[model samples]
Target: MSTENYPVVFGTEDILRSLCDSVSRVLSVTTQSQIRYSGMVQRISKTCLKPDIGCFVLFDGGFSGLVVINFSAPAAMELYEQYMLNMGMSKDELTTSHTSDEVSNVMGELMNQSVGDFTAKVARELQTHITQNQPKMMALSKQVILSVDTHLEKPEARRVTFFTGRNNIFYLELAIDRTEFIKLNDFDASEVPDPDALMDQVHGATAARPAPAVSGTSEHDELLNSLGM
Candidate 1:
């Protein structure tokens, strides 16, 4: 399989389109979607994007990660707003606690749909199975999620990112641990189709609308690398 992305077993556009469609279809509300730094997260070498409202990470459970996903600050806020709006609350009166809790709940469901779609595609392709549990909300700073002092185990840490739809930028530290990292190190392009063919489809699959500019490549890569894989 190709290293920049998972090898293209079936249709690349088919998978990504399914993912984007699934993300939009699953969310209960449409709360302004956007992206930041839509490119490679060099740190862990994970495919990442900085959404306007936040950032998030997706991982394979085979990596033995305790926490497989994470999101960013504004992402929390935007989701909190969506929850508030869905509940019929006025945006002006929203407070800190309400926003934090609401973001956690909304993002948790978002993680569910996203992971479900990802795993479903893999399962169908490999003819394997994966089951997902409820994802918990961090509701605190990005550091809080990683700090064992906060009681979130570190061993299971997977790739982290701040996926959002607002604008400024979001970040997540996606750690894959050494074990899974090794599996990826040996990966190549055998499973993927012609790079030109897949890249063509992958690029075409993105949003037609213009988006805000994101951060530098080196910076994004540093974040992904920290994730260990």
Candidate 2:
């Protein structure tokens, strides 16, 4: 008799969960606020970009998919303000309206970061690569629905609800080709790198390095002299 362990199967819902986690992780860290998603996910017939603010990006390669994040006006403003404040911007310097071009740009940037993280995880965990287009953002006063233009023979759509620390709500919609990954062999997934730790390492190395020798009366020497070095 032959003994073998069962292969691990990752299906549609697993992929959706991974994408949701990426969004939560990126936004939470960037804004220095808590971001949580619904425990239940909705199986939708199609994905659409809804009113207030809508951002979308398309990815292709190992799998083709579309990601859409629709934010309510309040939710968009909350996240934008939080992120800006975390970056050391004062409240007076922040925009009050979600429809402002600056608001759209900031939201787009956040979406880009989130999707970039998701793609990296796909490469590491799924052992496949995917490339994403630049995120597109729109502010809409009325309801508007947009779908992916790319072809997905058997598309699966899902929507997950996300909440900001202030309890503002947003929705994430995903449409992807129905697919699965079955692990054939045992392997550990790569650990995600910690940005804070990486920055500390860089600073430590710089501090330990000797200053480069400067010719007579150079700006570097002048600075060092001013510091009584």
Candidate 3:
């Protein structure tokens, strides 16, 4: 089974395409950015082109190893604005912005979808039922991060990267162990981690989770507090 492992599973290019497709289907977007993801597996050796948001791990339930997911600050901003803040974000707003769990929340369901789709695709080839575990979200600064790298105890792993955008730069990525696909659908929603508790943790750690995106930056930013993330 190990020999069948495909490094392309970690291919950011493919995952980015998958994510773009997944998000676009559920949410509308012009997809103007030229996103590019590094080809190498997400590792400390690879330099982050942007800020770090958080890391997520996947489990197959029985024997598969856990795998990690990561994104750069720019990518996170794109996700926050495109998915949550409405697909029209000015470059300045995205660059200067600080990340929060709210940002994570905007992209969480989409992230789950992307990974789940990737898992299903990989599993179909192997004739196995793959599922997603409840995603673990966290907030962190780029300063303390010694390494942008990630690894799993499983014997098998796959990594890849790509650049996407009008200029042909990769913005986002996903890494997976094909053998590690878990049966995430196996459990009911209640069995999953409480999003409320998780969000509380994020607010407690980050610089006050940004209130939900307001109608306009000014009018909305003020109203964000009342939205109750």
TM-score per model over all chains = 0.45, 0.80, 0.47
Model 1: how far is 89 from its true place, Å?
5.1
Give the lDDT ranking, best first. Answer: 2, 3, 1
lDDT of 2 by residue, 11-116 (tens): 8999999999999999999999999999999999987778899899999999999999999999999999999999999999988889999999999999999999
**Residue 28 in candidate 1 has what lDDT?**
32
Query: Which candidate tops TM-score?
Result: 2
* Per-residue lDDT of model 3, residues 1-229, tens digit only: 4535433333333433444454334323324443344434433223222336554545453234333445566665555565443555555554345366566666566566655665654444333455667766555666654233435443333344434342222233343333333232332322435689999898797876676664545756667767873
How far does residue 191 in candidate 3 sit from its true spot (Å)?
Answer: 31
TM-score of 1: 0.45
**Poorest stretch of ten by lDDT in candidate 3:** 181-190
Better of 1 and 3 by TM-score: 3
Candidate 2 worst ten-residue window by lDDT: 1-10
